[model samples]
Target: MTTITTSAPAIGPLSTSTIAPANPRAPSRKSGIAAASLIRLSGLFAVAAGLVYAGIQPIHPADVLASVTTQSWAVIISLKLAMCLAFLVGIAGIYARQAGRAGWLGLAGFVVFGLSWFLQSGFVFTELFILPPLASIAPQFVDGFLGIVNGHPTELTTGPMAAAYSVVGLLYLVGGILMGVSTVRAGVLPRAPSVLLALAALVTPAAAMLPHALQRFAAVPVGVAFVWLGIALLLELGRSRA
Candidate 1:
């Protein structure tokens, strides 16, 4: 009688049917923080790049064709590679910080300046792949390429090279202006660096007009601005963490 009166025990759902809750917000927050860190790193790289760029001197074009082992060529190539990396990363970082307020101008500037760096990489390609063989076999061809500096005609610079130069120049000139304006509007970064950026861009064309030997040195203002911006970004990061 006692057994018959015992009630049946209740049963729960199978463990397989029970699902764990998804934590969507945590992943997103983590990613955002990681991205911000990269942006901060980009700022540092920019500072380094600006310094490298400022110290760069144009390799003697004549010597490139004649000498197989010139230290200047190596240095020039190394500096250029550094600049390319810094510009690409730093600009991307800038865009990230200013994304909210950068608007059309910022986008345009980023695109144009970004392309300039891409094309500038082509110069490295020429130096590494094309120039050595050309120098060994046809030294005159190298001379012709350098001739464009004096406003002289040369087949070396006829089509692609000429176009590359024109486009890169235009991009740097226009892009810098746009980015500077947009940065000022964003108010995410300090005004001084942004103003300096604009000034550097404005003076860049004049620098090109200078003697080839001195043109690279014209990057001083640009370098200084980048250094300032990088330090500012690091300080800002520290403040935010606090």
Candidate 2:
């Protein structure tokens, strides 16, 4: 008797498709590193946004002083601090994924960058926020404070405060260069974004030292580049998820 036997279609190799976990963990260390790199890129963009705002409008000494005395300055300074903190955290994440002692250099570079931002921003904030109040109380303090506010007081500019900012600017330039190089060499990030970041690092020192008229144009390119890098990072992250 010929019996008609019904049989299920054979599944080839059991299809890893069916066995795969619903929420599969990232398969490779590279993926985790890439994710962390993307986070750092995003944080850098946040800091860049705050800087862009600071750059776009002219904050004269008087205006800065006024803003500091008011609650508005507090908000702005607070945002700046937040941005720096986010950047440091992102750096930490990136450092965690590194293989060997190289991570220490990366961490050091980021630390320097963070410290530079603190010093530079602190100088400005103090000149604007603290000095104004002090000047208000004592007319004698006005001249010293004004010099700092104008960013051109012969006494203060040539004194410890200016030296501090100068050191900060130098550290920023140097640390940025080092970090950019390290990032590129690490191979975790895309080449183009890394190149742009390195270029941004180079531009910062020039902008800080050069006359306003000459340096003003640099901001446009730097800002645009940072925004582009951020968008690219976001796209890459989305692609990895997909």
Candidate 3:
């Protein structure tokens, strides 16, 4: 009697909220993964190109020159240049993960390695193309240049180019060793490939300096080392998907 029964609140229809449908056409996790895979593939191709040019250096200098003049060398050189660019991208990826001074150093080292390739290729063009054409017509030009320094104007075999090659080779050798070490230390790549790259770095200089008698044998190790590095990179590309 003292309290009127409170009217129960009327139950209303259950509120229905509309949820936005995910766009099926939009890129998904899988698409992102695929894009990353493509980038890695490009990097692998670049490394392979660099190795091919490195291998050709010891095998057939004359043929390498002919190939370059005829534009065949462009294929490999372009590949190598692509590799350098890819390597810089890779280094950027590394920096994204690590975010430190080491990333900058690694990038610098990669740039040096890339520049060394350009230097080696340019040296070949000048010595094999420009100088030879000039010398062909101007032995007097060669002699004047050589004799001014008390050197003889001999045919530009590996001898004349050897010094330049050694310089470029040394740059690559040092740059490679640095980058390989950084890659291994940063865990950006597999240890095996990094180790193989380091070994290849050492081998180039050894092949360059080894007594002529032992160069043939020394070169075998260098070639094997590069092939091994390439295989390791390929394996890395496969493994990164998971």
- Which candidate wins on lDDT? 1
Q: Model 2: number of clashes?
A: 0
- Winning candidate number (TM-score): 1
Q: Roughly what TM-score does model 2 have, to 2 decimal places?
A: 0.59
Rank candidates by lDDT, best first: 1, 2, 3
Residues 1-242, model 2: lDDT tens digits = 99877565557878555676655565676687676566656646544653553454343223333444556555655555555555444444444434244476667766776676667666655654565576556544445544553455555336776566568768767776666666677766555655665677788765756755454455454344445445545565567666
Write model 3 residue lDDT over 61-90, tens digit each, in one string: 222223333454444445445544544444
- The estimated TM-scores of all candidates read 0.82, 0.59, 0.53
Model 3 steric clash pairs: none
Worst 10 residues of 2 by lDDT: 57-66
Candidate with the larger lDDT of 1 and 3: 1
In the predicted model 1, the residue pairs found to clash are none
Question: Whole-model Cα lDDT per candidate?
Answer: 0.72, 0.56, 0.52
Worst 10-residue stretch by lDDT in candidate 1? 60-69
- Model 2 lDDT, residue 224, Cα: 49
Regions of candidate 3 where Cα sits further than 4 Å from its true position: 1-35, 54-58, 61-102, 127-132, 139-167, 203-208, 211-229, 239-242
